[model samples]
Target: MHVDVIPVGAGHITQDIARGLLTPVDHAERLKTYYGAAMQSPTDDREMIDVPQLGETGPAEDITSQLPRSVLTGVIQPRIEETLELVRDYLEAGGFDGIGARRVVLTGGGAQMPGIRELAQTILGKQVRIGRPCRVVGLADATAGPAFATCTGLLLYDQMAPLELSDERQTEAKEQPKGRLARMGRWFKENF
Candidate 1:
């Protein structure tokens, strides 16, 4: 169970908007919701997003502006490529030698974006699948997509207790090599 965590996330889209937009938009929370919907089915055409009370002092008025799809795709696609590249580098570096290394399971809000699976497969030259919570009980269908994966995983993790080693096992662990591989193995054992 060798795992590599990449830091790129949905928040990056909001950051990109702040930097890439011609006119500054200060409402990140609203923008996240707006852009998140747009990302679900991205296209080449520009979109109009309406923001209410866009000004600081004037009476409430909705501001409609054009948001180019390139803004979202430009930020997202490259990050996905970068993530796959990192995984490739890890495999080449001999950090991950697990079974089914060529198969990638993408989970999280970003995974639901249209074309992401195809893009990842093309970039990684591997099979990629959107991950969902499996073997979960009492999970609503509405909340069962990749967006809720982290939360479901956390709930599952909460039920797990730390492994307790016996004196003999502790002695054997103490004798193991203190290296990167050893640490990773120990972590895998502890968590999984």
Candidate 2:
């Protein structure tokens, strides 16, 4: 199996806020809350986000700014399309173009945003689904969504034992003469 990854995170939204609103963010955590609430729906309506002022002398006042939906359509959506296009180009160059036809699973906090899956589907021309953490034991209900998928995956991965070659494979590996090319190929096959 071959997996291609694209880095799309909540930080992109924060950057978009800074760029679009032309405001330096003081409290990122508080801004994230506003982003989460504002992106609950895929609408053209403008949202009011209370952003903390950064370069203040004495007291800091919250800057109430109107967040236009263009942030989603103009900046965020274009970035997603560009990333997917890059992935498609990479797969094509590697002769794995057919892999692009498979369904896309959008994971992490950005996947929970409204209309993100639909936007991805439209861009990639493939079925898209928001991926949530699965088979997580004792996972709290609040953390069972796509936002916690990365954490759950890390926990699951940490619990897994390292893969060991079988006795037969170990014997075959030892019997083969270790040339530089052979060693390089073995390293690639093992890691990749």
Candidate 3:
């Protein structure tokens, strides 16, 4: 079995812009529209963003220092740890034999964190790596980052594991003969 975890904000770089932290002219700009510099268009793709209001003079120094760390620990890290633990416990219960019999794939924006793969390895005690989607046009650079992993993987699955029904005939002894007597007999046999 192959398993992949996609981060919550997997495909959206737009949230970073609407919060006033990033300029529209940035790479994420393509994801947003501008009504002047201040009024930015909302993005459906990005994870919801909440920014504390800043006065004209701007935020305090200490507040800025704590912001990134707070987001990492409170939001991003917990989600990763939770997902990894659940997967580990599930695989163990299913009798999956260690790293060789298992593959844990992590994808999504959260997986792009600098030390996350190492952190996941320490916790999961299994090999964990990023997922890359395949078989789509205009996706050469999509897998370069974790944000597009799920969408990419979906495309890849479409290419590799195209759905098909089994061609072999199935012999169900009970279902093979269909008639009123057969049904009545089967019912009588089961019931009696």
Candidate 4:
């Protein structure tokens, strides 16, 4: 019997950005992709961004919505911090508190943010690094990023699992004896 399950991935940095910016999700998403970071650095403050407006009398070429990079930093920082706090709470409540000193890998789309490694390490008290797909032969360039690491890992694991041991375990489980009395009970019940 086969069952389909959706695995939950960690983090929602984009959604947090979307809510904080008071912009449509699509526009907010582009802002986050182009300019989002865990904090504002000196270099970031020098940049200005033009974003799409979702307001009525629609988007016009001359009326582009503009904001300083620092404003973006301000908007996203609290939300990212709150998200990190929730991640900490989740790990602790799930009895993973001992991982404090271990190295944690941040993968997937949000890991591409400029300061995520430093931010995660600061908040989670663990060494954090960005992880991308590795050891995949003939992997297309498009799917070789951090976002694809999980699926690549699953594929790799499926290829490498020790099948004989798994088969032995399954055989042993299926053939377990019910014992003489239990077998007799089943026999009597079936016959009756």
Candidate 5:
């Protein structure tokens, strides 16, 4: 099952706090760094050779190996630890009991992060997973990844809404018996 993981910003806190603190630029930069770090997977040179078969090929550094473990453990891991703690708190506080959730979805481009789902599951204690758009008629390739999930979901949402008043009025007009005056108006509209 596909899952959508939305981004959390200062806005996730409270509107007042969000408005008081981070600006749009700050929020954007935070999201960029969060997503960038999440996508970075540790791989040695040997692993790089195998990646080519999957369409990934380039000079790469094994971040896990290259970075000092002390620094990573002190800084990186702590941040992840903090975030996970926050997620746990949020879920408990919000009361999101995992009922009928087959797979927890993490969507958005950020969902592509290498081990985020595992981290999230560990923290949230749920059957967590990532979600991607799939199996649409015209939007097959366009809605392929987590990044496109929101847009694809929105398009699907629009399709499911009831007809507007304008549409209902038009349908009513189509179904009604046309008097001579209405026919004359229709003829004039068509000719014009």
Candidate 6:
């Protein structure tokens, strides 16, 4: 139930795009941001994208245009599928019992990709939707997406949270009999 961290976050998809496309991390990331999709579409074959291929050793200067949208899909889709599968396992262990989530809400920057919800639905067998932050008064539109949900939520909660008594107050109210022998003697006296 405590599957906290695995190789399944938005960054993994970026890394996959970089390694799989043999592009520099920067360019791969740019391509991913600009063009990456979770599934293949009709335009995938026709449209082209410039993938940075560092030729031989140091070809950062060369900067050649390469590959199509489908290549990005080929690399990105598998990684997405793999990450979700691991997530499925984690969910199953964490009391889901393989029934899967009725509705999967994807958050963060990764969820912004094209066709992501559909891809998640296909692999996870659930209705998928992109989640954004709401119900917070005066929250900035820029910081209102899934990427900032947890943080914004905490901040909002903190503002509205009620104060409670601390442990020190409760302990201060009780009598503190110090030594172990004294405590045992008091217990015996009370019981006897």
For all predicted structures, in order, the TM-scores are 0.61, 0.62, 0.47, 0.71, 0.46, 0.73
Give the candidates in order of TM-score, highest first.
6, 4, 2, 1, 3, 5
CA lDDT of each prediction against the hidden true structure: 0.63, 0.62, 0.50, 0.70, 0.49, 0.76
Ranking by lDDT, best first?
6, 4, 1, 2, 3, 5
What is the TM-score of candidate 1?
Answer: 0.61
Residue ranges of candidate 4 with Cα displaced over 4 Å: 1-12, 58-62, 99-101, 163-192
Candidate closest to the true structure, highest TM-score: 6
lDDT of 5 by residue, 22-52 (tens): 2233432343334323313444212321101
What residue pairs are clashing in model 2? none
> Model 3: how far is 175 from its true place, Å?
25
- lDDT winner: 6
lDDT of each residue in 51-113, candidate 2, tens digit only: 445565545454444455444345455555566576557656765557545776767776766
Considering TM-score, which of the candidate structures 1 and 5 is the better prediction for this target? 1
Candidate 6 regions exceeding 4 Å error are 1-7, 55-62, 97-101, 135-139, 163-192
lDDT of 6: 0.76
Model 6 TM-score relative to the real fold: 0.73
lDDT assessment of candidate 3:
0.50
lDDT of 4 by residue, 82-106 (tens): 7677667766666666844366677
- In model 4, pairs of residues that clash are none
- Identify the runs in model 2 with alpha carbons over 4 angstroms from their true place: 26-33, 36-53, 57-61, 67-73, 93-96, 157-162, 166-192
Clashing pairs in 1: none
**Model 6 C-alpha lDDT per residue in residues 1-192, reported as the tens digit of each score:** 232445477788888887887877887788888998888999899999877685545566367666888988989888888887876677667766455447767777888888888888887777778877776767677887778765676687777896465889658536656689978988899899
**Lowest summed lDDT window (length 10), candidate 1:** 36-45
Off by over 4 Å in 1: 22-43, 46-61, 94-100, 139-142, 157-164, 167-192
As a whole number from 0 to 100, the lDDT of residue 98 in candidate 5 is: 55
